[model samples]
Target chain A: MERTGAAAIIIGNEVLTAKVKDENGPHLIQRLRELGIPLRSVETILDDVDAIVDAVARARRRARYVFTSGGIGPTHDDVTVRAVALALGRSVVRLPEMVSALHARAGDTPVTAEGLRLADAPEGAVLLAQPGMWFPVLTVDDIYLLPGVPQLFRLQLETVLARLSGTPVHLVSLFFTLGESALAAVLDRVALDMPHVAIGSYPVFDASLDYRVKVTVEAQERSQVDEAVGRLLGALPTDSLVRRE
Target chain B: MERTGAAAIIIGNEVLTAKVKDENGPHLIQRLRELGIPLRSVETILDDVDAIVDAVARARRRARYVFTSGGIGPTHDDVTVRAVALALGRSVVRLPEMVSALHARAGDTPVTAEGLRLADAPEGAVLLAQPGMWFPVLTVDDIYLLPGVPQLFRLQLETVLARLSGTPVHLVSLFFTLGESALAAVLDRVALDMPHVAIGSYPVFDASLDYRVKVTVEAQERSQVDEAVGRLLGALPTDSLVRRE
Candidate 1:
């Protein structure tokens, strides 16, 4: 693995049980893609420490970067901070910097007796500090810890993503009406020929548009992506109906 | 492995890419549970045939009964049926019985060349037939393929789920405030004591409320589930509050 991108490990029971709509996975996926990093897998599991530790260990081994959302809050189910420590075979201890950051944050709101605990991080973690923001991220061993709240998940990711960004998104999206079965051979050819550009297919249905297919090609440069996608579309049934719009 | 119940596989690029909110997984999870089947796992993937085939194959092997949602529509991205056939090493062809059924259902609606192709399925597959309101389910090796559209997905499921009935959901959830660090030993002991009941933990955060933990236990009977949950909660930290209306 030459370190091209990241994968997400979403640890939360609320998502699996349907109590909360999982926003972390998608939000991170989109942002990571825009930053030119492919999100490999989004695994949602219970808030169990062993499971979290196992997931973290797996992610650390595979992805160039690994980000986790949820379970890092001040409340009881919030065991991500501890679980991460256990995963790294380290002790959970307070980071003085994050504690001061929280004190400055706990200004207007009545920070609960246990709220201060949120500031603590696993020992030797790098703090992606946000004094005003509700959620804070602590990065250790390539894993960035984030809050599950959609708002916090987004804010922290923005601040953190800026620091570890790779390539910028560049590609052309072609939406047309076609069946994949009839075009599988052509797709296989394109995939074989264009190794640099990534092609993804998405099928969508709407009342007005009974059936539509969106083929997106992402690459390091716009010309490379566009040229590869152009070649693939040329082998299709009809190029006229295949609108680049 | 004797099939305990049916499993649901979520197929879509939108879901894997996190572009769209996935309703299929939760919907099928509830429907299958009501039908007395325990859902094994919900796997989301990009609109790639190989990926779809691999996931479908895995699901089919793990659970005697497998239901796939998404990837069976009228667009280029709709490759679920083809993928299933490929995974089974079968060929995709139009089923006359299904074609007639679809023709009758699309009575007033204009049937495009692509629309008629919706009747295609793997050879020798039984039709999980829906009188007129839903897409037909094609079964290959005990795997039932369903549509991705929520409305049609629900209609198609009703016909198949009705075949397997009388499985009541004996699961109760208790949300409380307690950190895992303080009660890891108690949870470990409970896991050993209760061999039958399923235990899971979820962490949730709300704007107005402090983050908390929700623990769920699933069993064959309500009493079994309740007793197990009670015993587990008792071992947790005292003075912790649980979720209430």
Candidate 2:
């Protein structure tokens, strides 16, 4: 399928209420950008089956790829599998291989009766195989179910995402320490002069000069980005600099 | 005005593409919740003046207090002041007191540039009074313009948020370690039993555990919260606990 953009559904109460800062969206966005894909939006929701199902449905309809982080766990709140199944209208059942793999991983934890349910997945769903690993690989359709854990999400996506590649996006960032009020006229002038190079300004609080402006140049060709940044930076105030990423 | 809910808008390209992790939203949400305000949503937008204006306008209509973080630096991308002017249809100009204050703060150095126009603010807007600060303090209606720099946003809010003493919110959390599938039936029982408490499930990922479940109960009374947690915890799969936080 021709890919357009990807979105993320972060399902966890800890994240929504500022209990934990989410890192998956940022991590995925960087990877997607490198692959030349655009990240559309991120929706953070509480750990409710209906909410997850609703968010997934909306994300899939809006984006070419929808990655769900969190909720694919082996606990009371790990409702991703069931919710995904319900969202897809599939029956839930235990896969033999997953059960065996989980049992092997647990050793003597009564995997069959207690932890054996980890093997359960929506009927007809392909198990991703996670024995002594983070997440079981599974692809139902456009959705990729990943562990809510940041490390597990990163590890699993590194392997699964290799199958899906995206086109490169030309982007540039312009950092500025110039007070925003004082730079409006220059920004307006630069933006009016160059609309294609995508001149973006970001405020860096880390700079001692009060603000740092990073002007990024992105284009199909590196030269076009360079030329655009050159022109845009020249039109801006004394503090603008063009940099390549 | 009496507090109802809180929300934040992060405006910047760095966050949009994952170039920088946004810290303002979570910081605000955490502090707001501790003061008993529920967070409705956190939105991230590009560095377009019109976009920022539109978002702030919308937030004013939805939330009791809306905070805009970013674009208040000494750079050309700092369009926050102008955007606030547009949002409220107010003419912006350099306030005399503000320029002198900033000049005093900047002292001698590259910081002085014909006042740097850091004082441009929407006409008749309430100055947040971070005097000597580059970001303008503008309170147009209910929306508050803030610096995207995490620490600055935190400090600036402290200066203005005291006027909005929030009502108290009673809440409790219960964590379950048993895999989600193992606790569905019992969770259903808890939901049926706890009718007054606002129950929400939070699925968390632990590096060592399968998945951790946090069940949050919010109510008017502490006893209600405590009872909800007790019942909710008891209803979970046996032997699944990580302690309430």
Candidate that scores best on lDDT: 1
- Model 2 over residues B103-154: C-alpha lDDT tens digits? 7776774444534666667788677666445554567667788877677778
Write the residue-wise lDDT of candidate 1 on B58-154 in tens digits.
6676567888877776555568889989999999988888678667866886565666667888876887657765556777777888777676777
**Model 2 global lDDT (CA atoms, 0 to 1):** 0.67
Off by over 4 Å in 2: A1-3, A47-62, A71-141, A168-187, A203-212, A233-245, B1-3, B48-62, B72-126, B131-136, B167-177, B195-220, B233-245
Model 1's C-alpha root-mean-square deviation from the true structure amounts to: 6.3
| Model 2 TM-score (2 dp) | 0.72
Candidate 2 docking band:
acceptable
Best by TM-score: 2
lDDT of 1 by residue, A1-245 (tens): 34536767677555554555677777777777666676655666667687688767756765778888888765445679998998889888887776676677666655544566777778878876665664457888788998776777788888888788677767677776764444445655686778777666555555487446666777788898878877876787675245674
Local accuracy by lDDT, each model: 0.69, 0.67
**Model 1, residue pairs in steric clash:** A76-B178, B36-B167
Candidate 1 chain A least-lDDT 10 residues: A179-188
Where model 1 places Cα greater than 4 Å from the true spot, the runs are A1-3, A47-62, A71-127, A133-136, A149-152, A175-207, A210-218, A228-244, B1-8, B33-36, B48-64, B70-127, B130-135, B147-152, B170-220, B224-245
Q: What lDDT does candidate 2 reach at residue B165?
A: 70
